[model samples]
Target: MTVIDFTAFIGRLATASGETILPFFRTSLSVDNKSSNDFDPVTEADRAAEAVMRRLIKSNFPQHGIVGEEFGNEREDADYVWVLDPIDGTKSFIAGFPIWGTLIALLHKGTPVFGMMHQPYIGERFSGDNGSAHYSGPSGERRLSVRRCASVKEATVFTTSPLLMNPDDRARFGRIENAARLSRYGGDCYSYCMLAAGHLDLVVETELKPYDIAGLIPIITGAGGVVTTWDGKPAQSGGRIIAAGDPRVHEAAMKLLNA
Candidate 1:
């Protein structure tokens, strides 16, 4: 089947995952630390949501592969793969912030062809297929687009947190933050989605997994923006990503990031 054929199915996945995760939001859910040296938090909600989506995918299309944050990969060599980050902003989620969202991406032979960021608490879903993007929720549905921003000095940038970055990377990112008209922390996947929606300018992040970024590439590119590594490679594999509404801004950020 063509990639377009998967649109409705993606909606179903988002809905199912959203339903599975909503009840745990802002609740006294138990969290587990996935990292011994750092605070990499994972909750039952993350696992449960991913489990629900994985089951649906396996039942509906047994031939497909799956890669998830909570659960490991399965049949990852298959032509079609689904990359999932059930709660892209688990830290924000546990802190009772609505910035968290469910990230789902479909890759065709390792290329992202479809992506969605579903924030159930806010009743919003941002979806894309490289060619175009759309937003649907309480505010109603509309096509998504990125606003023009030509320079870092004129741009608003976001990162989940500079603290998440190591010392060298943090110093590098400080250059952009210093030049940007505005810089804010704590967005996670929502920052990328907002960049896609024309509400923001650039999003710079580091140390992201495939599941963290695979689902966001299409949405940003589809909305007429650009997403890439700091050195200008494709971002699907996820590391030191810089996304901007304007290519000029992207170039500027890349130079700063690499300088």
Candidate 2:
């Protein structure tokens, strides 16, 4: 199938997953810990949404593989793979926050070519292909592009938390944070969407799994932003990430991160 065909399917995929997720949004649903500690949470919403999306992919394109946070991997050697993070921000979701969203991405031969982030409660969807990006919400449809900033000191920076990084990385992050004029913490995947919308300048995150960032790369880059590993390489594998809406911001931030 052509990209247009897959794009149409992606729209439906997000809608279907959103339908399964909305009901559990603000409910007193039980949350189970997926990590060894009680902090990392997983709700039925995460699993149910992933299941619905997985079912759709398997039914429509059984040849494609799937890498999901909840269900694990299947048919990974296939040329096309669907990456799903049903609730990209479960911590915020369980807190009754609207910033949480579902993430979906398609990788062609292991290279991401399409991505979408959908927040059902907020009625927002951010989508992009390799060439362009767009936003859909109550305000209606619009194109997305990042704003230009000459330097990191003039930019607004964001990170989920310095705590997400190891102690050494945290100290390295502090150097960059100190350089930025403003630093806001804690938005998870939504922070990247905000950066693409020209509402923020930079986002640095660490120790993320592939599922945490697979859907965000396209949205940012298609909007004229740049995303890379802290060492100034592709972030496709999703470990240490630094994304900037402006290239200059990226250049300045990377210096501090790599220093």
Candidate 3:
């Protein structure tokens, strides 16, 4: 299918997921512990949204595989795969924080070709393919590009939360945070959108799975941002990801992260 054709499907995917999720936002719903430590929270909304998307995919593009946060992979070996995180920021969602959104990505032969982050509550959508992004929100629709802030010292940084990091990763992140002009926490996927919008300069996080970062790469890169691992490799599979709005800042941050 052409890029235009796939984008139409992406739109429908976002809408289906959002409809399933909005019902649970700010309302009482069941929360369960999925992590072995009983700390990683999953809610009914997360599962319902993913289920809705999966149904849509199975109905429309039955050959395309799916990798989701709530449900395990299905036909992952398929050349065309859809990576999904229905509630990318489950913690934020449960906390009534608006920073959470749904992440959707289309990967061809294991490389992401399309990505989108949609927040139905705020009526915001950020999407891209390759290295370009477009945004739609309460204001209007516009193409986005990251602003240049050529140095790390002039940069503003963000991470989901220090608490989410292990001791070692936290220490490593601290070095970068210490170098940035300002460091804010608790943005989840929203901060990545902010970076794409040119409001933030750097974002570093560890322990992310493919579903977490897959949908963000295009949005960030499309807006003239760079996303890579801590050591400066492609971030498609998501390990320790560091995204910088400027290449120089990304280089500097990588130095601190690796040092």
Candidate 4:
């Protein structure tokens, strides 16, 4: 068995992803509509970034499995699998927003063990593996931790789309909003990266698949954050995700969700 050194692999993936995304950062490209909604957009940047990562993974980890947002599953039953969301905030990237990023995660026997989120446009890379998370960029490397906010009233919260939630879910999010110190929208994968970097407190949302949360789990957990479902269970649940700087903050957010 080829035991992958997750820490080193994450550094390589970050470098490769950044190299793939930089050229397309602000270039005017034809955007394709994935859905009738204006918010559902995909661009060449998204495809190209994923393609690059896939290519690298195939070359380096030929035996590993892969699942990507742009590209579907391949070799899914392998002992090692990679979950990818290249250009995670496609809409934001297409609209010239800097919130987009490349997300990569490695799963060992169905458990996430390593992850990296690279914002190529901003030259920021957040990496985590083996219970430790770190941020790298022009500023340098720094460890991250989630906030220890004991109450929702003192928490800063974030979500991708309020519109994607159903009426009841929206109401639940509203209750969370009411309890939070502040709430914001439109961060996408970048929000989770911020959480890993200790800049954000909580990120709650519904309708996330394995790919969406896989890469984020290691990063957040490595940074001393708790990632779980809104019901306070493991985040591997397909329903919803709630990420917080501290376990207490996650529990407090859970109370608001179940309220």
Higher-lDDT candidate of 1 and 3: 1
80-103 in candidate 1: lDDT tens per residue?
Answer: 999999999999999999999999
Q: Which candidate is the best by lDDT?
A: 1
Candidate 3: regions farther than 4 A off: none
Candidate with top TM-score is: 1
List the candidates' TM-scores in order: 0.99, 0.98, 0.98, 0.93
**Residue 23 local lDDT, model 1:** 89
For every candidate, C-alpha RMSD to the true structure in Å? 0.7, 0.9, 0.9, 1.9
Q: Report RMSD for candidate 4.
A: 1.9
Report the C-alpha lDDT of model 2 over 1-259, residue by residue, as the tens digit: 6556799899999999999999998999999998884378999999999999999999999999999999999998899999999999899899998878899989888888899999999899999885899999999999999999989889899999898789999998898889889999999989999999999999999998888888999899899999999998888789999999999889898888878
Per-residue lDDT value at 149 in model 3: 85
When sorted by lDDT, best at the front, the candidate numbers are 1, 3, 2, 4
Q: Name the lDDT value of residue 79 in candidate 4.
A: 91
- Count clashing residue pairs per candidate: 0, 0, 2, 1
**Arranged by TM-score, best first:** 1, 2, 3, 4
In candidate 2, stretches whose alpha carbon ends up further than 4 angstroms from where it belongs are none
Please identify model 4 stretches exceeding 4 Å from their true place.
1-4, 36-39
Backbone clash tally (model 1):
0
